[model samples]
Target: MSEDLQETGAGDRPGPVTATATPTVTDTTAATGRAYGGADPVPAASTAHVAGAGRALRGAATGGGRARRAMGRGRGRHRRTGRVTATDDRPATFRDVFGVAEYRALFGAAVLSWVGDYFAKVAVAFLVFSNTGSVLLSAIGFAISYLPWVAGGPVLAALAERYPYRRVMIICDVARMVMVGLMALPATPLPVLLLLLLGASLLTPPFQAARSAMVAQLLTGDRYVVGLSFQNMAGQSAQVAGYALGGVVAAIDPHAALVINAATYAASTLLLWRGVRPRPLPVVHTERRSLLRETFDGLGFVFGHRVMRPTAMVVFSVVGIIIVPEGLAAAWAPSFGGGSQVTGLLMAAPPIGAVLGAVVTRMTGPERRLRLLRPLLLAAPLLLVPVLAAPPFAVAFALVLLAAAAVNTVLVPLNGLFVQMLPNAYRARAFGIMQGGIQLTHAVAVLVAGALAERLPVPLVIGAWAVCGLLLMAVSVTTWPSRQVIAEEVARAAELNRAPEPEAPAPMPARPPVPAQPAMPARQPVPAQQVLPVPAQHAASQPVTT
Candidate 1:
C-alpha cells in the first residue's frame, strides 16, 4: 500500500489530518484532487494522531497540503511504479536522417537529376529563343516541362505501383538521356525537339513518385521529416548550382550544355542501377486496380479525407502564391533596366532562401514546427505586400528572399504532417497528385502574372496578386484543422503502418479413401426344400393340447 499524510495547522492546534491509502502501483494525488502526469486519483480518509512536542510545533508553522499540491502540478507520474518523470526536450540532428545508406543513395541520385534538369531547362530555352527569335516560343518551351504534369501526372504516377521502383527510376533516366541526346543533335528540327522534350518530361511524374515512395520506406518516425528537409535543401542547392553553371555554359555553346545534361542523365542512371536496391511494387499484381481508377481514387481520398483536405488546401495555396515571384522574375527584372543576368539572380533568390529555411526547420522538433505553420503562412504574403511601394531592385530582392523563407518554413511542417496523415499504400499516388497541383499552379501563376505585367507595372501586378493571396490565406487559416484532430489522425496512421501484415493461409492435408464392403449371396429354393421335414407324432400331440 502507498500512503500520503497531510497535516494542517490552525494556531497551536492541528487541523483534522487526512491519510490516503492506495494499492501498490495505484495513482495518488494531492489534497487539491488534480491529476499529476495523467495519473488516476484514489480516495482519501480522515485520520487523527497525536504528534510529539517537537513535531507538533513544526507542523503548526507550515501549511502542508497546499505546498504539496503546488509542487505536483506539472510533474509526470509513472503508471506502474508511481514515480515522477521528466520530459525530454532535445532537438533532432542530421545524423538521425543521413546515417541510413538507402537514404544517402536516394539523396545523391536526386541531386544529380535535379541539377541535370535545371541545366537542360536553361539550354532548351536558349535554343528555342535562338532558333525562333520569339520570346513567346521560348517561354512556351520553358513551360512545356510543367504542362505534362497538368495533363496526366497522376495517371503516370500510378504506374509506379505497377512496377519495381528501381526499374521505374532507371527507365525514366535512360529515356531522358536518349531524348536529351536527340535534342543535342544539330539536324533535329525545332518541332521534333519540342516534342522530344515533352515526351521526356512526361516520364518525370512516375520517376518522382517512385523516389518519394522509396523515401517513405527508407525513413520512419522523426527521421522521415528530417530526411525530407535534407532532400529539399539538396534540391534548392542543385537549382542554384545548375542555373549558375547553365548560364555560363550556354554562353560558350547551348549544344554543349545540352550534351552535358544528357551525360548527367546517363550518370544518374548508372548511379541508381549500381547503388540502389530493387524493391517490389507497392501494389501486388492480383491486388492492382486500373490506372484511371487508382488515379481517381487517390484524388477522392485526398479531397474527401478531413485532415488531408485542409492540409492540401494550405499547401496548394501557399505554394501557388510564393511561386509567383520566381515565375514573374523574367519580366520583373527587365522592368528595372536589367537583362538576363539580373533575371537569373532574381530567379535564384527563392531557392537560396528555401535552403536556409530547411536548415532552420531541421533544428526544430516536430511539435514546435507544427505550431509555427499558421504563423508562417500568414507572414509569407504579408511580407510580399511591401512590393506595392515600387522599391528598387535590390530592396525588392531582399523582400522576396524573406518572403520565400517564410513560405518554405510553412512547407516543411505542412509536408511532414501531410505525409504522416496518408496511408503508406497510397503515398506515391498522393505525392504525385500534390506535386502535380504545385506544378500546375506555378505554370498558371507565371503565365497570368506575365500577361498582367504587359498591361501594368510589374510591381503593381505582383503586389495586387499578393494582396489577393493574403485574403486566400486568411480563409485557409480560419478553416485550418485543429492540432488535436491532426495529431489523432497521425497517430492512427502510424498505428496502421506499424501493424504487421497478415500471412497467407496454410494449405490443408489430403485424406485417404475407405475400402468397399463385400456383397452377400442369394438363397436357393432347392436348399430350402431339403431342410423342410416334420414329425407326425409331435404334430398330433400339439393339436390335442391346443
Candidate 2:
C-alpha cells in the first residue's frame, strides 16, 4: 500500500514519468528541461547497451562531457573535409570548381592556345627585329598585340556572356586559327601582321570570359576552385613553355616557329570542339538597356561586394607590386653583370615557385587553408627579403621563386572564394573588369619600374619594389577575415549548397483529418525493431528531408 502511494505521488508530480517494468528510453533528460545524460540524447536500447550504460553513468556525474564529445565526433564524421575543396578559401584543385565537362575542354583549349600565342609572339618579335634591325619595332609589335586587351577586353568579355558559352568558345578558336594561318602567309606585311595580332587580342578576352563562365557551369562547388587552379597552372606553364619554345624556334628559324604556333591553334580548335559538351543557355532578360549602366553595374558588383572588392584589390596590388621587378628585369639583369638569359630566369622564377606552392596547396586539406591565411600572407613577403638584400643571381632567382610560390598559394584559394561569391549574371562582366585592372596594373608596374630605374640603380629599384611587396602583403595579412566569421559563413554556404531540394507534392484524395481517441487497457509491450544499415540505393532514393 505504501509503495503504491509513493508511485502514485511520483506520477502526479505534473512532469513526464516513465512507469514501464522494462527500462524505456522516455527522454527523461529533456523532461528535466536540461538534458543531463550528456549533450547527446539518452541512448535507447537500439544503441549498444554497454555504450548507453557508460554514457548514462558518465552523464550522471560528468555533466554531459562524454555526450558532447560524441556529438562532436558525429559532426566530424559527417563532414566532407579536404584541402582545396569548394568551401576552402584557397581551393587549388580542379575538383574545387565542380565537374562541369565544358570547363575541362575549355581548360585544355586554353593551354594550347596560350602556349601557341606566346610562342608566336616571341617568334614574330624576333623575326621583326631580325628583318628590320630595329628593337623598337619588335617592342611595338608586342605592344600592339597587347593594346586590344586595353581597348576592348571588357567590351568583348561582356559579349562572351551574352552569347552561349560553347558557341563563343568555338567561334573564338576558329577565328584565332584563321588569324594564325594568315600570319603564316608568305606575303604578309609587318603592319598588316600587327593588325592581325591586334584583332586576335581583341577577340581573346571575350573568349576567355566565355571559358570562365563555362567553367562555373561545368563544376558547381569545389570543382570551380579546382578548375581555376588547373587553368592558372596551365596558363603559367604556357608562358614558360611558349617562351622556351619561341627561343628555340627563333634560333632555328622564326618562320618555322610561326608555322608551329599556327598548327597548335588548329589543334586547339579541334581539341575544344571534341572534348567539351554543350550546355543550355542561362535565362536572358530582353528588358535591359544602356551599355554604360551595364558596365558600371558590373564594376559595382565586383567592387561593391565586401569579399570581392578587398580580394580584387589585394590581387591587383600584389600582382602590380611583384611585376615591377620583372618589368625592369631587362635593365636590371645587364646591370647585375648578367644578360637576357638572367632576365628570362627572373621572369620565370615566380611561376616556378607558384607551381610548387600549388602542389603544396593540393597536398594540404581544405580546413588548414581557411585558418592559415594570416600566417601564409605574412610568409609571402618574407620570401622576397633575400632578393631585396642583393643576393647572387642564383639566390635572387630562388627568392623570386619563393615569393611567387607564396603569393600564388594565397591567390589561388582567394580567387576560388571570389568566384563562388560572384552572382551568375555578373561573372563575365566582373572578369572583364578584373582582366582590365590586371592589364592596367601591368602597364603601371612597367612604367613605374622604368622611371625608378632611371633615377636609381637597378638592384636598388628591385629591392625597393620587393620592400613594397612586403608592405602590401602585410596589409593583406592584417585584413584577413576573422576566423569565427569565416567558419560560420563557410558552414552556411555549405549547408545552402547541400540542402535537400524540394519535391513536387504527390496527388492525394481530397479529405479532412479525422481525430480518434485510443482505448488504453490491456496493452502489451512493443518489441524494439532493429534498424538495418541503410543500403546506398535506398539512401539515395530517400529524398533529402532537410
Candidate 3:
C-alpha cells in the first residue's frame, strides 16, 4: 500500500495530488506476470483473476480506514511502527525541513557535535605533542579517531538497531562528555589520555548511525535529500569554525580547548534527550543474530541487491578518485614551490565547490536533478583531464573546483535515491556500510596516490588516476539500472512502509480421511476476497500463473 502527496511549489499554495496502492512481488511471475523462461501469453481470464487478487491485497494491507487515518495525522506520529510517509512532490525548501520540531533539534545537535569533534581533534594533537614532545605521537592521536570507523564501524552501528535510536544517541553523547572531560584533566598522563580518547572515539559510529537513520523519519521525500545537503554544508562550516577557535583556545591553554569540547558534547546530550522522541527498533526479525552476523548481513544487502549495488558502486568509484586532490594538496602545493597560504587555498577549494554545488542542486526540482546525475558523473573525471599537463597553480585550482562541483552534484541525487531504495529496518546498518566504505576508499586512494607521486610528477599521477576514474564511470553508466527499475524499487519501499502486521494463521478445517493415492501437486492459496482484477492490456503484456 502507498500514498503520494504532491505539493505544487515551496510555499502554501495547494496542489492537486493523487494516491495509489502497489504491491511487491513474492515470486518471479508475481512481478512481471510472465513464466520464469516461457513467452506464452497469459489468458484473459487469468489476467482478470490477477487483477482481482491485487485489489484484495491492497484492501488487506490498508485495513479499511485505519491506514488512511494514520496518514491524515501528517507526521505519521501515531504509528509506532516503521511505516514511511508518502513521497511528496516538489523540492523542499530550508523552511520546509527546518520547520519540523524534531528536525530542528537533530540539526542543532549535529552542529554542536561536529564542532566539538573538530575541536577535540585539534586540541588532542596539541596536548599529545606538548606532553610527549613527539610529533609522531601527536599525529597518532589525531589519526586514532578515524581508525575506529575503519575497523569497527559496521559492528558498532549494528548495535544501534538493537536499541531505541534516542537511547543510543544520548548514551553515546554522555559517554563522550565524561571521557573528554577526563582527558582535559591537568595531571592526566599522555598514554592514559590517548587511551581515554580512543575509548570515546569508539562510541562515535553508533551515535552517527542513529542520527542518520533518524533523519529519514524526521523528513520525507525530497526534504530528506535537502536535509542531507544541509548537513554537508553544516559540517564544512563547523570544521572551519572549530579549527579557527581551537587554535586560539589551545594557544591560551590546550586544556581550555578540551574543556570546550566536553561542554559541546554535554549540550548535545541534553538537546537529544529533550528534543527527539523515542522510537522503537526498526528491524522486525524475531530470530536472534550476532553483531558480526548482522554486520555482514548489511554488507550483503548493500552489494547483493540490484538497485543498491549500482548506486553504491557509483558512489564508491567517484569518491575513490576525486578525493585524491584534497588528500594530496599538502604535498602538491610545496612541489609547485608554493607557500602555506597556497596550500590552504588548495585545501579549501573542494569543500567550497561542494557547498556551492549542493546549494545549486537543492534549488533544482527532483526530476531535473536526477536527469543531471549521469552527466555530472561523466563530467567529473573529464574536467580533471586538463591536469595531465601540470597546469599553473591557479589553473589547477579552477579545474579541481569544477570537478569537485560535478562530484557533489552527483552525490545529492544518488544519496536521495539510495535512501529511497532502502528499507526502514536497514537504514542504520546500510549507512554504516556506505560510510565505512567511503572512509576506507578515501584512505587507500590517498596512500596510493601519494606513493605514486614519489616516482612521478604529482600532476601526472593525479591525471592518470582520473583517466582510470573515467573508465570506471563509463562501466558504471553502462551497468546502471534503468529508470523503471529504480521506480519499481521506490514503489516497493513505499509498499513496505504501509504493510500491515502479519495476521495469525487460520486453523485448518476438519475433513474426512481419504485413501492415499499418487502424490498430487499442491495448489497455491488465493485470497479471493482481497484480490483485484488485472487490466486486459497489462495482463497480456505481463502474465501471472500459479
Model 3 TM-score relative to the real fold: 0.77
- 10 residues in a row with least lDDT, candidate 1: 5-14
In the range 1-546, model 1's lDDT, one tens digit per residue, is 001101100000011122233311101112112111223243221111111223444554586654444334323344484332332112346897778887777788888888888888898899999998999999899889878799989889988877888899999999999999999898989999899999999999999998988887776545766677778888888887898898789877888888988998898888888878887765555676789999999999999987788778878887888888888888888777899988988988898779878887777654345445566777899888889998888998998888888888767656755776677668888989998888778778887888898899888988998899999887777665543354345445544445355887988777666777687688545643243344776764454310
Error of model 3, residue 14, in angstroms: 21
Q: Cα lDDT of all candidates, in order?
A: 0.71, 0.62, 0.73
- List the candidates' TM-scores in order: 0.74, 0.72, 0.77
Off by over 4 Å in 1: 1-89, 285-289, 334-341, 499-546
The sequence of per-residue lDDT tens digits that candidate 3 reaches over residues 338-444 is 98888888888888878878797678655446546667787899888888998999899998988988888778667766776678778899988888888888889
What is the alpha-carbon lDDT of model 2 when measured against the actual structure?
0.62
Rank ordering of all candidates by TM-score, starting from the highest: 3, 1, 2
Q: Which is the better candidate, 2 or 3, if ranked by TM-score?
A: 3
Winning model by TM-score: 3
Best by lDDT: 3
| Weakest lDDT window of 10 consecutive positions for candidate 3 | 1-10
lDDT by residue (193-299, candidate 2, tens digit) is 87788877788888878877666556543344445555677688889888888889877877677777778777777877788766655646466756557778788
Clashes of each: 0, 28, 13
Q: Between the candidate structures 2 and 3, which one is better when assessed by lDDT?
A: 3
